[model samples]
Each structure stands twice: as structure tokens, then as C-alpha cells.
Target: MEIKDSVVLVTGANRGIGAEWVHQLRERGAAKIYAGARDPRSVVCPDDRVMPIALDVTARGQVLAAAELANDVQIVVNNAAVSYRQPLIGGDVDRIHAEFETNVFGLVYVTEAFAPVLRANGGGAIVNALSAVSWFSFPGMAGYSATKSAAWNLTDALRLELADQGTLVVALHSGAVTTPMGDNFPIDKIEPTQVVSAALDGLQAGQTEVLADDISRVIKSTLTSDPSRYAAILGG
Candidate 1:
């Protein structure tokens, strides 16, 4: 679906890729944008076309409230997520659970609440900000990787289930981005604008999955390979 003149809602829009998406969507001629953040006051977009909404996706009440307020939305961007750095087995289980709360359950809640909204608006689109880690695990980020993997599956399942409704479900997978989420990671990072652009482009082109960067593409290519080989790489 064309983004021009569409009403779009982006979660985590206070900063990072979500913020970039809000700006780029405006540039693409989006009629209205609901920028959702834990603290709506933190959203810096000053346009009247941009409405900042208080939304903590992990909170069911906030999610439902945002959905009600943005019922005219034609597109929903699930960009809010949390990451906890630790090993899987002996890791901080509490932190891992927190990560799942925000990254996995939050996403599900938001999508479920907005599914009907999208249907009412004539079957629009849902964009999920996934990660390269969704395809491969990384040391010290095992919990984060697991959540993203679950999100990837959720995206796929939603795509299939929402097909009859004409709701386009798109998943964008990439390596670390130049955002707070990428802090302390020594690897090269892509700009948030690049990720947003690629995802919007894919949405316009009717793509269900967008591998937004080289790292994501490379990791996805390994899915068909011997599981042991990929496991060794992650283990090392």
C-alpha cells in the first residue's frame, strides 16, 4: 500500500529508527502519524500532522488506549523492543523475562489490538522491526535473539492469518543500527534512515519480508545450511 496520504502509527517513536520512520513517512506524504512512546512528551516531532501518544506497549491498558485513539490508522509499525545482555543458561533470568515482556508480548498485544483497526481502515499494513539476530544467536544477547526469533515467527504467522483480510504484514530484519540499541557494539551499523527507507520501500513493493542490510541477508541465507555449522559460529 502506498504510504502517501495514509495514517500511520509508529511505536517507540521517541527516538532511533522509530523516530526516523516518523520523519520519513512524513516525507513520503503520510497524511497523519501517531507517534507512540512510553513518554509521549519525549517525541520531538513538531508538526501538527504528528500526534504523539503515550504508549508503553508492555502495558495492556496503554496499548489499548493508543489503539482507540488512533483508530484511523492505516499502518502500524511495531518498533518498540528491549534487549538484555547475558548468556542463555546462566544469564539473568529476570532481565531475560523483562526483555520478552517488551520485545515479544508487547508486540503481540499491540498487533492484536490494531488488527481490527487495520481491517476497518480497509486492510492496511503492519511493519515489524526485526533483527539479524532473529536468524542467528549472538553471545551475551541470547535472550534478545530468542525474542526476535519469536517475533519473526509471529510476523510470519500474522502474514498468513491476515492474508484474507488484505492486511499486509512486513518484517524488516537488519544488523545493529546506529541507535541506542547498538551502543557498545563494535560492529558496523546502518543508519536508522536507511533501515526505515528500505522497509517503506518493501511495503510499497508488496514484500512480506525485508532484509534491510547485508548482515541480515547473510544470516538469512544460512537458514538452509547445516544447523551445526551455524551453531558453531554462534558458539565461537
Candidate 2:
């Protein structure tokens, strides 16, 4: 899982945390980076080591193509996701489907396509960009939170499934990050660079999960506490 000399692929690399991963990976001496985006032309990294690949994680064909093209990738970062802030009750179900399409199923598609490639490359690592909401729910973000919760369990399953192949599945959880995705939220946010840095550090150190911010750490710690305690906070 050493970043140095590793060939990595990051989904949704056109912007946000994915873009930061490309930058930090280059700084860590990654030999090559396949920056997968829905529109490859949108990838803006200046590093020569970066190769922009057209990939839409929700599309199986595109995911397969990316897996074929980036066969040398030793690390796969599942950073592509969508979030729709809407309540579960009386909310547009379409929005929930959209979030799950990108956040949950898209992740599954990407990982499935790349599992063999990772095994071929000496069982590298898969880093999933999860969220603190995976452990707790917020009113307006019910759908987004549910998708992340699904992704959290998915990561755990993948870890066990890929263990025989030596592939390390790492889940990175955090609250809002300073990106377009977090702009609407007024809460304190972690810089994208900081999230990427902590994730990569955890990956190299063979950690299964890395809580990238205080909110994430706190939320995770409360997972085993009495439900009523958090229920009161959620106004249930």
C-alpha cells in the first residue's frame, strides 16, 4: 500500500476530494495515477503522472473499460458519489435512487471490476470515501446517509472477501469536507487535502478504517451507545 511507485486509480477525479487524492498521491511519489471521471477532459491535475480516463462508475461498461485500461492500478479509490439533501418522508424517491446509484451501487460496480486487477497487482488496496453519517442519521440527508451506511457495510464485506488476495479495503469516514459537496453545510469542514493525507497514511499503515475528522471519530464512538441517547439528539 505504499504510495511511492504505486499505480492508482481514483474515481470522480475531476474535482473535490478525488482531485485532492490525485495531487497528494503525486506528492507521495505515485508512479502513475488514472484519474477516472465522467468526462475525462474535466480532470485538471497538472502532474504528468496523471492519466485522465473516462469512467462513470454507475455505468458498467465504463467501469469495465476503466478496469481494462488501468490494469496496472494497484490502488483503487472509490471517491465518486452523490448526495441529495431530502427527508425520507414525502421526499422525491428519485433523489434517493440517484444517491444510491452513485454512492452505493456505483462503488460496488467499481470494486467488482477491479478486484481481479488488484489481485494481479499483488493485492493492493481499495479506499472507499465513506461518511460520518454512515454511523448516524440527519433529517434532511436520510437518503445520502442510508447510501453511506450501505457503503460502510459493503466495505466490510469486501475486506473479508479480498483478504485472501491480500487486498486491503480501507474505509475513510468524515463529516463535511471543504468542497462543493460541503459548501451548503454551515458546519466545520475538513480540507480535502487533509482527508486525502489521512487516508493515504492509514492505507500505508495497514489500517482498516480512518476517521478523518473529529465529527467522524465522535460519531463512530457513539455507535455502541444506547439508541435513546442519540435518538434524543436526532429529536426522535
C-alpha lDDT score of every prediction, in listed order: 0.90, 0.91
lDDT by residue (tens digit), candidate 2, 1-236: 79999999999999999999999999999999999999999999696899999999999999998899899999999999988766799999999999999999999999999999999989999999999889887668889989999999999999999999999999999988999988745567889988998999999999999999878887887886466745433436
| TM-score between candidate 1 and the true structure | 0.94
Model 2 lowest lDDT segment of ten: 227-236
Q: Model 1 Cα displacement at 112 (Å)?
A: 0.5
Model 1, residue 208: C-alpha shift (Å)? 0.3
Alpha-carbon lDDT of model 2? 0.91
Write down the TM-score of every candidate.
Answer: 0.94, 0.95
Worst 10 residues of 1 by lDDT: 227-236
Model 1: how far is 221 from its true place, Å? 0.8
Off by over 4 Å in 2: 224-236
